[model samples]
Target chain A: MVVKTVEGSFAVAEAIRECEPDVVACYPITPSTHIAEDLNRMYADGEVKKYIAVEAEFSAISALIGASAAGGRAVSTTSSQGLLLMHEALFAASGMRLPMVLVVANRAVSAPLNIWGDQQDSISQRDSGWIQLYCETNQETVDSIPIAFKVSEETRLPAMVCMDGFYLTHSVEQIDVPEKKLVEKFLPKFNPEIKLDSENPLSLGVYAMPSDYQSFREDLELDLQKAKQSITRVQSEWNNLTGRNYGMIEQYMMKDAENVFVAMGSVCGNAKEAIDQLRANGEKAGLLRVRAFRPFPFGEVAGALNGKKNVAVFEKAVSLGGAPPLFGEVLCALNDLSRKPTVSSFIGGLGGKDVTVNNVAKIIVKIKDGEKRFEWV
Target chain B: MFEVRFHGRGGQGAVTAAELLAVAVAVEGKSSQSFPVFGVERRGAPVASFCRINDKQIRIHQQVYAPDFVVVLDEGLLDAVDVANGLKENGVIIVNSKCDASALNGKLKIKEGMKVFVIDATGIALKNLGKPIVNTAMLGAFAKASGLVGLESVKKAVNERFEGKMAEKNVKAVEECYNELKQ
Candidate 1:
């Protein structure tokens, strides 16, 4: 592990380069632009085998689908409207079971046309059949890329490693970039078991009538849930190699705590500090950081918040007229609890609003004071 | 942990300055984080960046609201933005201007006991780098005024950030600024 002080985006690019992808198809978007830029430079310098500068994000993902179908370890990075532009293709990539990786610098979608950090972009694609892993720090983001690729290949599903835009992606810090040999040992070359071959011609993503469509959907769902095991095993393997352990949900100060703040992405960092401050004031506050959002980690989340007095679910995206995305999921996870925690929903930090430690501590205090079921922090 | 906020025009290297400081902090075997205020930035718009240095891992990911030090890259920003807002008492403000302490005191609304250090970073940059980019020069003043980083570490960070003549010139600017600051 070589520790270097660099921008998070460049660190991610370096990690992706070490993965030695056969093809990288990308269209530049703010916050995520530096990754594409660095990879394109690597491509020009002959470090990467192929780099396709697509006109738009739709074509970028479409090109990745083709690349992955042709048996190449493919990857792409995008954010905000760019991810939205590839909405249809996202399902297509996953529906076809094309194992690939996408790094999303999570940003707010716009009718107001803002370019800032938020989880609304990736959260809106929750049903796209891709594994979603949110990161709280640059080192975790760097580590998640290789883990995403390994899990994607193992589960035959695509993975989106979501790092907060302008928060993690744009931040500069010191991180350990893993050695190429270690990654090589951890991840074997992408030799797909099946691919588009003219000699042994086969079809993929063919029309699935109602008779078979439901079963195919069920298979993908089951495989996504089972992929959690693969994620854990791979992450544990990575831990053994690097001494950095990660889990689907990181429980911070949860033991003997009555109240917990649940969140994803960089907001978890602020929440952790808030937990520390609350503990100082003799308040028993904990933080549950949801690293893997796709597999949903229902068992672990339910286990952690099983007997807590209050669970404040803070998220960057809302489900509009419905329950917020994460809040709704947490509610379901804790549904079978004999004594369910009073899980409150909070929607804040949208459009890159600074969700400071103070805001997080106050929410915990409000939860203690029996605040409403939902709030806009 | 010590937090520093930087105020500059969008075209200036405020963000890069913060990053350089973070890298220098790393050279001292400490952890640091730096980031710019995200926005649809233009060349001349007022912009801000932040840096935090600590002995352990810096886990907080929010902007530095109450900074221990404020570094202003352009004196023009003093009239345009609240460069000193949320600064803690006894904090230090380093400005890249020719103005002395009393002149800058009239312009800034700082709390009592908060020292204000003035350096002609532009002049230093012109003499050493032959450019108006005062980011590296300001960092040198920051190193001296804040006593958070060493001059050699800042020079090494500059060398890491730039190559060849650019690195040499920036290091010279850093040294000149460090020598110019009385603190």
Candidate 2:
């Protein structure tokens, strides 16, 4: 049975319930508050089990870390500054190889005090060693929750499901929510290979001497390297069950396209629409949606743009004086390709500047007409 | 294919209005897409949303420029946003206002042959829902003016969205607005 509803916050809560998460640790923040509120209400009403309201975002993640360590399917959610507060714990979660899932309501980091939508919060946490999946719609937001859990548990690394705040979080949309039985069928009980057990009394987070630290780090690197394949396998299994397929990257009308715009999150929807309109108007345009940002599907992305003439990377978050964050990654991914497409980086939608289809259409026209390094005004 | 843009403020249910319209169109077996272009706009600050309804799949992801219909949920936004910026010649403009349609024509520049429907949505909301939020009421006027979807479809959509007393009140408001348009 498919139920239609609005509000991504409630959608997240419903997905969490369908997944039957063993533990949910959350802290309240603007935009992200509704997600936690919905989850807490569900837990209080006995719709879910073990809802832990922590004092801070740090503690919220720490609780999930603890719960996951004890072999429970743990999850949590946060945004912007709250995510920054949990930065230290993020590294810890990755270092210990804990497969916890986090819902990051993407928000602009504050200094001038902007509570709007952007990707800086999640983009800044790129080095946190968690597998990040950006969602484009409320349906994708709900769909990614169960997928995140499966991917994280398979790779034994944390997964961050990021969506634009207010855009996907607070905004209401008609979302198709999967039934409980189907969700259960898709995602079975998570059983971690190595867990903290009192009977075994295994040592976790033990002090690593300087000499052995490198080897431990190497093992972590190997696990993350294996995550790329793991994500594909799990997503394939999920597709078999739900008939809704997702990937590390999803290419839209990219076949035989000359110009391609690469983006993630909700903006991809706008970009895809622009591409379709352009194509109908007899322009060769397409979109490349980066679903899995971490383990950064470099091979798949490079392969998608193999024959494209030009590519535009639209980054929602800026990297100070550097190139747009996602653009930089795209460049690095295609650095060694023998015949690479000319790439232009466009920085936009920062501090929540409505990146409309008009903006995307303009970008495509510019790229097709041979303008590079443009910024959406 | 028709694209409608709704301009209002945060907490005014502009996005909700778009979703309800999408559902109504879907009830007629037509394809529709409804999404909001969110901003840092707080309560009373200007926000905009878009809805596209067509007999086929809407593959264009662009914002609705040159919209066939424009619904102004808050008259106050008229000063800040040019609600008639991209209105087509045959388009319809539905506004929630107490002023006369000619008054809006004087204040705003619209193309010739474009239809304008003005309703005291604030008055309807005050009487029916006990609030000045005019999204639903203005949506009622939009359905009547544009004929994009039948009143029955919109009433069913509204009833599906709201429940009990609130649903009854909104359904009544929609029917009342429809009747007011008919006369």
Candidate 3:
């Protein structure tokens, strides 16, 4: 297959069409609209068998849940407020252990109204029991679709494939899209035995008595913990077919890094510039990009940050009235280390704000100056 | 690495121009990325876009702060925005206007050593494509002024983006403006 220059949304759409899911039900939202629109076009062309028309994000996920329950390989997409509307359904989809994939074009939640890129939408739902995978490039966005499907079906846990909304969605770049044969080889058709049927009558998601309620929640947690392994396995397996490697978290220039900045999604691109320039000037700086947010990858994150002199956790989303979410998590990951380094939390790029190379360089300087706690760039 | 910023109104094909340049560079076996600053801007609103071309893989996903070249599709944006912000010391400014390079230098009041190039792209676009969209025309001038992309590559890119008569007219717009541009 020849590499094509494409927008991130269009690449994801191509991957989705190649994946050939049984149903797609989504309400259009900014940044995420292209994904749904492209899928809609495929539906019009008879490439997809079912495309459900739902009124709201709430109904969108509910309908996908029904489709998955009826033995259909279901998929849907939403962002920000739409994700908020589908909150209950998100938990239900995972609680019932349904294998569905929700493509999230991550965007900022709004009180003042913004349509640009951010990680807040998906970060808010980090506890909703779905496997969250954050992507950095358009090529990664295309690859994550089938990897998502494979992992979701294997573990019976829903997965959210999140890419920075307009940053990647609107930007055009070079990417190699896998062919249909590779996709089919990677993911087989959804087996009917997984769904409800008259041949094998059973009860699911039934009301649990108090004695067994705690155990059910325990099982969900255990399944999620096991998902960390499956996520890594799928990435390696996909690498065999495509010759590209996507890790749970990526470490760049970490071999002798004295100061490290941790981030996710598109900001990593700018961070690389800061690292390169600082290294040129005899400074030891590096970056760690956390690709798997839901499973968290705490051990790998802590290991990468262990011996560094200082660390800065920067994010586009803030937890509001608390340490920013990513910062809090990184802190939790590093808390038990005997030789932990200085950790600081910084927030920038909120509400589609520009996360520039200079902003990243400033964060590095602040880390050197021994700044503690949160600072906005 | 060569960085460029494009200033224009929404629906003026500024983003399209950036993407076309990126595609052209990619077609030539280089790495490039292009995107709009006003990702969700409304039609007719002021918009800015950026592109970066490099022999190696270009990874930074930030706006073009210090651009090697800046293309202005509408002269009205000069008063409405800072058209000269963060321009390199020896940068080039390409404008789509009827004035000559000397008047553009006086109008923009650019720094010493900075070069200004002028093309009546709006006129060429109107004459050739029957519209005020000077993006492709400016791109043709950009290729000539910066010497980053060949004229044939620009024409092929424009042709790939548009179809039949529209593609032919846009290529004509590019050729006419690039040939007539004054520095």
> What DockQ does each listed candidate score?
0.88, 0.32, 0.74
Give the per-residue lDDT digits (tens) of candidate 1, residues A70-91: 8999999999999999999999
Winning candidate number (DockQ): 1
User: What is the TM-score of each predicted model, taking all chains together?
Assistant: 0.98, 0.89, 0.96
Model 3 chain A scores worst on lDDT over the 10 consecutive residues at A365-374
Could you say which candidate leads in lDDT? 1
> Taking the tens digit of each residue's C-alpha lDDT, what string does model 2 give over B125-149?
8889887767777767888898789
Instruction: Indicate the residue-level lDDT of A265 in model 1.
Output: 85
What is candidate 2's lDDT per residue for A41-78, written digit by digit as tens? 99999998989989999999999999999999999889
The per-residue C-alpha lDDT of model 1 at residue A146 equals 95
How many clashing pairs in candidate 1? 0
**C-alpha displacement of B167 in model 3, angstroms?**
1.7
Best to worst by DockQ, what's the order? 1, 3, 2
Clashes of each: 0, 2, 0
Candidate 3, after superposition: displacement of residue A78 in Å? 1.5
